[model samples]
Target chain A: MTLLDFARGPAMQFAIFIFVFGIVFRLVGVWAMRHKRDLSEPRQPSAWKGGIHGLIQHAWPYKPFRDKLMTDYVIGYVIHLGLLFVIFFYKPHILFFQDIFGFGWPALPNGVITAISIITIGALVIALVKRLTDPVRRLISNFDDYFTWFVTTLPFVTGLATAGNVWWHYETGLAIHLLSVWLLLIYFPFGKLMHAFWFGVSRYTTGSRFARRGGMA
Target chain B: MSDATTTDIPVDLESKRLTVTRPDIRFDKQGELGDDERVQKAMQHFAKDFGYIAANYMEACVHCGACAQACPFYEANPDPKLTPIWKLEPFKQAYKREAGPLSFFYKTLNLKSKVTIEQLEEWQELLYDTCTMCGRCTLVCPMSIDIATLVGMARHGMFHAGLVPHELYTVTEKAEREGSPLGATPKVFADRVEWMEDEHEVDMPLDADKADVLVLMSSIEIQKYPESMAATGKILNQMGKSWTFHTEGYEATNFGMLSGNTQWQKDMTMKIISTAEKIGAELVILPECGHAYQALRWQGANMLGRPLPFKVQHISEFLAEAVESGAIRVNKVDKSVAFHDPCQVSRRGGATPAPRKILEALGVELREPESTGNLNFCCGGGGGVITIHRADSLRYKIMGNKLEQLDATGAEMMVTSCSNCRQNFDDSGEKLHWDKQMNSLLELVAENLVEDTKS
Candidate 1:
């Protein structure tokens, strides 16, 4: 089969299957690990509240760390919001989702979608630059970190390239975009990208643990 | 940081010098050197000790560097390896290779390097000597990863590998074999109590038939600062409370927790639990030791596999409760003081308000620094870092941030509830020629006790 046909049909289905199966397997595997029962009397009434609160509090830079991370924090939000807007609000993307889920939301104007895609690409580029340039970040980052960034940034860049017909045929660009997405879906369950799911778990557990100790989680 | 000297107390350089004799305990090394045995042992330990939260922390870190800014060691040294998340690489590697969903793929692809004994030896400094397990990194981590607890688990693996620093290794060995890290045996404990009783002219009530309160002191206080023990005795006596110091279990500090030996931690905790149970004490008061409070108040029940028969209280907590209940009244002193919250007692143990309550009751003008209460900076001497004689310079360097914070408050005296913190501050103050006087909260209260009119 041609690359485009594989990317559009079987590859997409396989990526979806791996994505779903891998995420569930990872989450359940982690959950199945034995938790040593905490026999100590909790200082707080409920650890659940602390866990939920921790999730909310960590959405923004904590007060003490804000000054040092202001630029990164703002840019991170911009990238996330831009990705969400471009992913779900584009006309073609909505139709694709409708085909799968039997429901769809209204698409944004073409101009707005293009604008978000450009901004998101710019933000992702900036993030990559920071990761490569900053000493601490550069030290901790590995090939997986760079590869994840590349995969995440590729879809927006490819989509924009296709819509504007800048470098290649629209069909070829779209094929590459789908392939990049499949790569991301398969890679999502491994490496640092698991932060997408583990962030919530980490926050909740840390919050609950701190609350049990009667501290602000 | 302020240069204005507000206190008359001079820097006691001589007293600040710590004279710790390294114990002659030989580490067990039955296996062949450089073999995969130690690495396999550490990996097994990591698999056994870690749970869902630890797994989440290991997987969730994005290398954002926020935790690096929060860590005092990283702040002082600006070293990348000292970053809290970086210290967990070994454990994370173990998790990925052993328990991750894609472990088979990782093994086949050789995606990550295997953990080695040499790597663990290098991580020893990062996990124990430099990091104080202060939990400051937990506060700033955007993922909310509990890096401090992860480091603690990492220490457990290191302990199994026999990679612990000789300082901590020696002390833990002594505590396991001799029953006290400082070699404060039962006779030495009794002698110290008798000396305090004679000096203070107050009854110590040694091994009372049945006391409402059982007071536990650390070997540090017994060996170095008997005044803190004397002050605790005076406060309990003045409050007209039934209390006793059991010679069998007076040492509150647990080297097991510090040394990352779980069995030793349980054994040390059981000693105090059995003693308190035998005495029928309703409350067990931990002396001015931070880890001691954590060893009992927090992890005691978990180790015992049951809830404690008696409630454990830190001396600061006990004093705060006494003051609030009108059981002890104090004349407020007119000194401007700032409180240095010990990491274990305030941050981990949740006794932040207790010391403030006691200070407020004493009528001292309490000055709060930028980092106080739950967010208080560690004194850089906790987690057995002070025991390592070679770490003295690093401790002084890392403590510079805390010294500046305390100085910025412009208080005449710095008060803390932990003897370890006091020792750290004393060392740093003397080394830097800092002029602020350091005071223990318990001693300050004892000195300012009002004459009872009811008598």
Candidate 2:
């Protein structure tokens, strides 16, 4: 078989593995965290509604309700929004769907994906640089933070390289993607990234747990 | 802990040890804080969940120090170590160890990880003993980070560890054993109300099975601050509202707020719910304990495992509702006084029109503090911390910011809706030397009360 053919089959296999194993690894890590016994009485139906209102009190457009969040929340929002768009909307992701899963859809087109990638990359790089330079982040940051930023960016970068499929032939691109996907998965169950899933569940449970009971959250 | 600061961490205790010594209130049966084998396991659980929420949700914090400007303790002590978030680090470090990847390489990084026995000792002061879970810090975070929620979780961890404040645990023990936090037996609890009945024909009824309102008092009010009960008694009689204070479930102030022990909190809640249900109370009126108001008004339903068989209302709310309903009339006193906002009533309710309406109704001339309503300062107490003498130093330091605002008002009386605030205001005044009459709104209102029908 040609290099492209071999790369395609194995690459497809690894992509499916990453999708399945990566999530499992994340779930395992999250499940390991304790389920706080919501001694907070189970909420009532009306109270559950009140709880929704209570949690909403802290939400963005946070100006009148919470002024403390005024400063960098907008910045954080923009950065995250950009990253989300790029990560999920990239041309290669669309290509992966079409080629690997034979799904039909409108892709971001390569140029738009590339532009979005630059913005996301720029945001992250600035954040990392700021963490390194800022006294507060520097003080609070451990090796894990720096390592997390570096490790998290790998899938993005390798995906970029693999997207171009230009340098070091298709073989190099395929290998890098395979290795990065695996490493990311193995790291999932152990890293801070697992917060993605657990934070929401914990927050909703916490809100539900304490919504109408009495005191504060 | 300087020699001059009597309120500083005590010398009476050479070292801290975990003990749940009050045999009267056995909370072991209510130890339902999930799968933790020990308090440490609970501690670990608290840290992981709290830390992850802070990390991912709070990841974007710029640390611009805006929240520092908001914290009264930060402004008063200026210790930098006492900043709300700084106070959170001991718990945060534990979070890092259990849920952080840094745990994978803890020693290599000098993470200072682990909820060590020593660390738990510091948390006793940091989580419960000092910080009040007032929600001011949460309101100030740039990420809208709920530092207060973490405080709640950490407090639960502390409660699990049996590190509840001595006074509150004592109170809870009394409530559990003697049926009142003050160790007031049903007979004594009834006698206090009975004394009011004997004098001036004023009575706050006890266990009126068909009462419309069930009044729940913190045990402190029973023994030390019966004037509040009398004011409530006088007002209910004037308004002719169907109300009774429970002799058996007389205690509403839960130690869980102080200790973070969910079981005790739950049990306390059950007592209130069952009492309210027994009396067929349509409305449950919580006395002026700020946290207690939040506990029953907001949280009691869930802890009861269903909607409370009755509606829970704060005394302020009840009084406010009465005045609004035109059942009672207030002649705003011919006086200008500043209102000290209880953190729970102000922030939790998101409005203060009720008491303000009461003040205006009382004919009391009102002078607004520069910070009033939602922006009003914390009364330097809440979260059951004021009872911890060891936390007094930090507590009073935080009180300075509040005092400054009171002084700004130049109002003769600092009217508040909470007993905890009243107590803390008194505690702070002894040092700050402010002579402002720290009055409970209900007490003050009931004293000047005129019947709306008569008017």
Q: What CAPRI grade goes to candidate 2?
A: incorrect
Clashing pairs in 1: B332-B362, B332-B363
Residue B158 lDDT in candidate 1: 81
Write model 2 residue lDDT over B1-455, tens digit each, in one string. Answer: 11122111221111111122332332222233332344465565476355334444333333434455566666566554556665666566665555544445554565555556556655566666556777666555534556766777776666555555555455555455556544456787788788867765676678777788888887667665778888888888787678888775777777655566677778878877888778788887888877787677666765776656766677887787788888887665777888887877666543356788788778776888766676666766677666555666766777776778777877777788877787777767787777665878888887788755551
Per candidate, native contacts kept equal 0.68, 0.05
- In terms of lDDT, model 2 sits at 0.63
DockQ of each model vs. true complex: 0.71, 0.11
**Top candidate (TM-score):** 1
lDDT of 1 by residue, B1-455 (tens): 01121111121223553323432332323223354777877887888776776777777888788889888888778888888888888988888787766678778888877988778878888887788888888888889888878888888888777677766766676777677877678888889889988998867889887899999998877777888878988878888888899987888989888878889998999999999999899999999989898899989999999999888888898899999999888988998999999889887778888998898888888999987888887888888887666567778887788889999998888899888888888778888888876788899888888758463
Alpha-carbon DockQ of candidate 2 = 0.11
